[model samples]
Target chain A: MTSDLIAGTPAATGEGPQEMRSRSELTAKEVLREVGSVLRMSEKEASELTSSPVENDEEQTMIINMGPQHPSTHGVLRLMLELQGEKVLRCKPIIGYLHTGMEKQAEELSYMQGGTNVTRMDYVSPLNNELVFSLAVEKLLGIDGDIPERATWMRMLLSELNRMSSHLLFMATNGMDMGAVSMMIYGWREREEVLRFFQKVTGLRMNHNFIRPGGLAADLPAGWRDDVLTILEGLPPRLAEYDILMTNQPIWRERLQGVGVITAEEAVALGTSGPILRSTGVAWDLRRDLPYLKYKEVEFDVIVGSYGDSFDRYAIRLNEIRESMKIVYQILDKMPSGDYRIQDKKVTPPPRARIDESMEALIHHFKIFTEGFKVPEGEVYVGIESPRGEIGCYIVSDGSPKPYRLHMRAPSFVNIQALPHMMRDGLIADAVAVISSIDPVLGEVDR
Target chain B: MSDAVVDSPAPAEQLYGCVVTYSRGEKVIHASRGNYIATLKKAIDDSFTMCTDLTAVDFLIYASTNRQLPSDISGERFEIVLNLISLERRERLRLRVQIAEGEATLPTAFDLFPGTEAMEREVFDMFGIEFEGHPDPSRILMPEDWEGHPLRKDFSVGRIPVQFKGAPS
Candidate 1:
């Protein structure tokens, strides 16, 4: 009698509304086969199916691959997500598609040319990479104190600007990932202005290789002050527009708030840093804590988030741009006057004019360029507060022209570890939000 | 060499009996070869919660005879360098564990700081140093089918010559 009833009403087999609707939508042949299978099953099995339709349907978790080429991943970062219905059970971020072996290549390059290599690691924050590598080399050389005052201020200025540009990129990409299309346009517009200034100062849009072991590539170009001021003055209004567009928007709030929450304990355990670690309410900025470069002299607040949610991460990065601008303004006001590169003839090549007149200057230039400066046999780890986090360069110099082993403790690589913890038991959609909030660059991750 | 000597109290002094302290440039390094895992576990318990980096250096060619290592510590062909930081104390400590050329096994630090999981895998992939008890021990930055550890000093550059479309192969 029960089997006859099941055949008559195939969709009414004690399934939930969702399961029932899906069952009803199936083709006649599928329904017939399903009914036939149900009829052949025991009464106990039928009762179990009817009692817990949702559970029965979701018995098997679906494994879905997010990307190694997906646009939302920012670069070639593939995330294998195990999903049960709409929720993600586990996520594994598979990287190394963009592995350029930059660290291996750094061993072949001399210290003078090392800046150009490390700069390409975090392509967005090239200056920070160059700065950390140079600082490590300088520390090995035991000449950290001898770096000229003017050069220090210039590095500070350029780094802060680089931070602003990197954060701007985050704001734009984060907006696009969360479905705010206009932010893509607005974020790029402001970033383009910063890039224009970078071009004028460093002579490249990206991977400038301007910062060197001893000092900067050259002094700040003519009219650099006005160019910097123009960017500083131009950013606030656009930031206000961002606030209206994303910060106050209900949809944006709904998608981000209380989503991808990671506690301070989890963040630290996973070794996540930069904004991701800061978002967990840990107030542990390397700039403030370690006090590298001239960060000690400058006054800027470390923007920290309380809940450590995706929203907090977004808000922190947006507010950080304002803080970086503040630092840039301070650098501008206190711009020191002197040689941009160090005056040490062994480290720095002589001026173009000096090379023309003096045979000694020409010979010094040739030697420095060809043979390169040899660092003392030692290993030093220099960690700087990059826009991402603690971008450290661990260099082991064997008293050679080239580093024996150059290891970059890239923040992106560390921060990506937290993604599995963040995505665990969260909806598949939230996984996208969480990854976007992490703001990882695959170049650094794979390298 | 004198300037590299850290006057600060050595935190890992109690953990290992043979904890040799030396200065490498401006940084103070606490080095040990045997019982590497226990020393690292002690460091973690002593507020070195953050494992900033874990990398290995192959000193095949650059092993200078005038190396500044202490007399008690024997040098090896490969050395695993671990950088740890105590966030509360705001102090950084470096630990170097020397692994012999043929024997490349070191106990994992993943149980201490879960962050070292990927770093351990990277060390294994690049330098061929195996971390025992690692949750996922596999090639991180290289393909699984890769022949040799690329970062070893003995590993060749593995250069592939480039050819233009219309030019000779």
Candidate 2:
């Protein structure tokens, strides 16, 4: 077996230099090779930066471990940093502290139960995770176009509202990381309003598996429009307060202006999307560029930044909240009244009322809940823009209720790759800012 | 998932010296292990600058039944799925490369898309498919000392032994 072959190899213990190596252990030639390969740069470029040979170095560079437990590292992300006096020479993010083997778990869950599994991956924006998985399953079931108008618009509304709450949380953490302690309270105060609305709608604050495969689990609750309106009405003034507190403050600008900078080419090469990519002046929002659901019908700007620095990323997300508000308002104005889930008997189970009248309805409900509806025997990949970046779902079905294979292309996982390149020349103090700017949820990253 | 029956077969075409098949309206290219990197380079030349995702699927159980592929390419034990998107064209292209169980290795695409570093590591860690030229070819999610490829079908979902009151040992 493959497992035996892998275990049999004596060098199976050769786990590569997973951590950063110290200057004492690496020769000049080896240093050049390691730097060039780790950063994905040419040897010539790497050598030019390390012009002074390793032999003549006065102070030995030190490699230190930063948090799998550091509060500012944002949920158990460990970094192996090689620092010479405060300036970081190399940074390697050591992750998987949160891996519960969700991909393996997905293979055991049915299509109807899969949303509950994926929603927990990115705890901040659970709706988008569920949305992408549902879209992929619907595509495989060949019911992508048959989704009711109300369901599509409802999905859009929930997704946009979740983006707002997610960015609000980022505001809190980013502010806390940057030493603006009061901003954390203010950010959470505003974010609580949004999460309250989510709880009213989805019955949970964080991992709401309300957005199911065919459509939503249930329709909008009573007074949902008013609840959404309350959130919308309450946020603008608080956002303007944020503008005064951080956006225009001199200390805030000074701390983040040029720290952890990345170029447009580098951002694209790093496969970052959403605000990080937009912060590099690449206007690639999957909503505007790809136009899924009712995004095409809505009017909003695809905010982009030219400098690609920490400040650019910060401002991009700050403005994205207002843009999300604009989308939510449009959705409020245009939300169609119809069934929230599809009426396709194959994908959607019989309504609860139907079970009282007919035996077939009870049988269908029991069968659907227990066995789950089967998706076609094909593979499909679906990508949607989450608050962090592009969250993609790839599924292969082998003619069964459970997926043959399920993989989530987590945006935070890829975005964390840019950490090493971003932290290479920055100070150790700025490492927190770099990580906060990337805003990686380690649950998603490790998953 | 559907029952063990083949969907209507579609005609096959070629792109970048590999088979071009569509999976639910998305374009997919079935590249061999030898030309995987070359195909990625060509894709970059054609403006597929951003590699959205790189993942692998273990086909250990579905060796024969319910497998979807073109008539020409034989199904292998492992398939590497690469999803690339062109910002200019706003179109996505998927690349699938097959690897047999005995020789489960392919050249890395890190040179083309540096973002794939972690993803390739993940594929290696989970499915035991080695990328030949990968720099950090170690595990990403799993612990380095882990025993088996957890995602492969052969690797069972393990359980701790349970003790029951009224049962024979």
Best by TM-score: 2
Residue pairs with backbone atoms closer than 3 Å in model 2 (clashes): A374-B1, A375-B1
lDDT of each: 0.81, 0.87
DockQ of 1: 0.22
- Per-model TM against the reference: 0.87, 0.93
Question: Which stretches of candidate 2 lie above 4 Å from their native place?
Answer: A1-14, A27-59, B1-11, B63-65, B159-169
Each candidate: fraction of true contacts kept? Answer: 0.33, 0.56
> What lDDT score goes with residue A281 in model 2?
92
Q: A334 in model 2: Cα distance from truth in Å?
A: 0.4
DockQ scores for all the models shown?
0.22, 0.36
- The list of candidate 1 runs beyond 4 A from truth reads A1-59, B1-27, B31-33, B159-169
Per-residue lDDT of candidate 1, residues A222-259 (tens digit): 99999999999999999999999999989999999989
What is the TM-score (0 to 1) of chain A in model 2? Answer: 0.94
